[model samples]
Target chain A: MYAFNYHKPATVAEAATLAGKHADGKLLAGGMTLLPTMKQRLASPSDIIDLSKLGDLRGIEVKDGVVTIKALTRHVTVANSAEVKKAIPALAELAGMIGDPAVRNRGTIGGSVANNDPAADYPAACLALGATIHTNKRSIPADDFFVGLFETALGEGEIITSISFPVPDKANYQKFRNPASRYAIVGVFVAKKGADVSVAVTGAGDSGVFRQKDFEAALKSNFSAAALDGKSQSAAGLNSDIHADAEYRAHLIGVMAKRAVAAAK
Target chain B: MPTVSMTVNGKPVTGEVDSRTLLVQFLRETLRMTGTHVGCDTSQCGCCVVHIDGDAVKSCTTLALSCEGAKVTTIEGLANGDQLHPMQEAFRENHGLQCGFCTPGMIMTAVELVGRKGHNLDEKTIREELEGNLCRCTGYHNIVKAIAAGAQAMGAKA
Candidate 1:
């Protein structure tokens, strides 16, 4: 990795200021993605503003039926949090299924969502559970937060503070993971709140994560794994890689969605 | 250059290193604690696993500067002089290693796993937790057995 200035700001204001000061400054959370990317020479930031010192950005809180997770909270914390498990076990399960126990120990939800890796697990949870991405500047709905692959609605120097997920009546996330990398080959998160239902697909989208309207509609009528019977996901615009072809991914989407629905509590 | 001070294996050590230096490099080169191996630098292989602040992490991917003032425990720290840690002893008794290249990391990860899950670990759970630690040798049969035995020994020893 290239040597650059490193600053551990204790406050969000200081972090934002430091980020705005340097043109190529990057905010360092867990450095799970950023460090490896930098090591591979895929990214070269002029400065690294470490947010690990920001104590306020590391926690989990549930209030008014919504679970709010601080951006810097590690995946292990989320996976083991009783509050998260009670409020949204699917989110906890998703967190637990990330890279591995070691990676979960270091990787942060904020880093995962901010990086917006097409195959990342958190994006599916965010979109399916109707999460609200709260930045230092404003709040953006999950639907609008993710723009494209490796992209988000975050503006320059806009730091994500926390993500607020509404506790769904029933929700579950299932993934067909790539054995080697543990990345989602095809992940589906299904959530139903009263009459409203949302189905989000990740790792199989050409434009990154997206809501499956037809599946959501099907679940809205009958919330069950069998509801997806004979329902098909179009292969158009889905991701095709060495791991899985677009058509196969489209098939896995149906399989995972049904599993997610069956597994939802 | 960054000056990082930390407690390694109960010894307070300090070093001046490049900001880009990985924790494994600091341990293997500066401190000469080579037990923490770097099998695959890409963070996929668990040969560089060590306990930072009591959590097992990949030292190859973790920045040395980030571990300032943290407590680090490598495979070398697992034993008390001639007395082997229960996990290490279990590995030996069970013939858990073949090449011995992945033993340090495997032991480190297993030690932490036992700490978190305790000695009553099922085979599936043990296998799942051992995902990070890879071994080209042993086919993981004896390693899994060693972890279960180690966890029991740890419980009995405690």
Candidate 2:
């Protein structure tokens, strides 16, 4: 732990200003990811700009067909919100199923999506539900938000204000949890809005979170598990580890997509 | 060294710690609240669980400086002198502990679970919720019982 400056700003403008001042400033959200990286000496910022004190950054509001969840909104908060549950129970269920009780209590929807952990659950929700990552600057579509494994479109000094998830007619997420980490070795989120079905897979891919166009196309034809009974995804870009192989992950993409469709039943 | 200040286990404390001092280290080494154990540094283990403004968080992965001006409740805050918190009581009553290493984290996690969603809770829900906070001792049998009982007790108390 090298010496560094710390600042807790009350407003987003002040926070952004502070971020701009420090050369190696890092926005401190829940620190589920940032703190550990710092501890491991993987990251060392010159200053830490704490966002927890920023009141304007926390809340969940559902208006019209849009579900806007503030960046600071905890997974527990989102999971328990009556409005969120009513508008999109699948999103609530996804939040409720993050890691465990401790992780969910502290981990924010913002932090989870920003970290862009390949094994995270929120990215699947973001991609499948066609959410918009609203930053202090502009809105980045979900398709463009996640750049790569452990990467996102977010830049230094740029803060994510909130995410806008479009309310879908039918949506569900099914994950095959890794035994040790409880992370999705393979998780799939299927969102159907009107006639379009978006299938996003997380946890079991080299590309972090991604859409299965083949699965989506098949499901759009007939939104059922039977649709995936004869189709599968390509294994070229999937992840392989002791937990699971690339081929298995590809297999899981098809299986979980089917299960997710059935779960949305 | 960075000057860190925060309220922990119902007490206001101040200490000059390193810039990278973890909340768990600050609690154990500086503040000496050893009840919150540090099992793993990778944020995987919940043994260092504590409530940062009533939210159960892995202390090992939390920076002490980041918790400035925030209220933190540790495992030691559960018992009121002699009476155990309902979750602790349930753990004791159900023989939910074996090694006792994971109890503090288990109680904290259970407290968080009820705090999050009490009405929407069931046995299956409880089992699904506690996947991250691992307890290698109990084989999760009695731990599940303890959490269920604690949830029931917490609901009754609520």
Output the number of the DockQ-best candidate. 1
Candidate 2, A1-265: lDDT as tens digits: 5556778898888888898889688888888777777777788889988788877888999999999999999888998899999888899988877777777767788889988999999999999999999999899999999999988998767889999999999999898988777789999999999999999999987979999998889889898889888897888988999999999998888888888999883
Tens-place lDDT digits, model 1, residues B78-129: 9989999999999999999999999999999999999899988888999999
Query: Which candidate has the top score in lDDT?
Result: 1
Runs of candidate 2 with Cα error greater than 4 angstroms are: A1-4, B114-125, B148-158
Question: In model 2, what is the error at residue B58, expressed in angstroms?
Answer: 1.7
* Candidate 2 lDDT score at position B152: 86
Question: Model 2 compared with the native: what TM-score?
Answer: 0.91
Query: With candidate 1 superimposed using the best TM-score fit, by how many Å does residue A51's alpha carbon deviate from the native?
Result: 1.4
Model 1: residue B68 alpha-carbon error in angstroms:
1.2
lDDT, candidates in the order shown: 0.93, 0.86
Q: Model 2, A146: alpha-carbon shift in Å?
A: 1.8
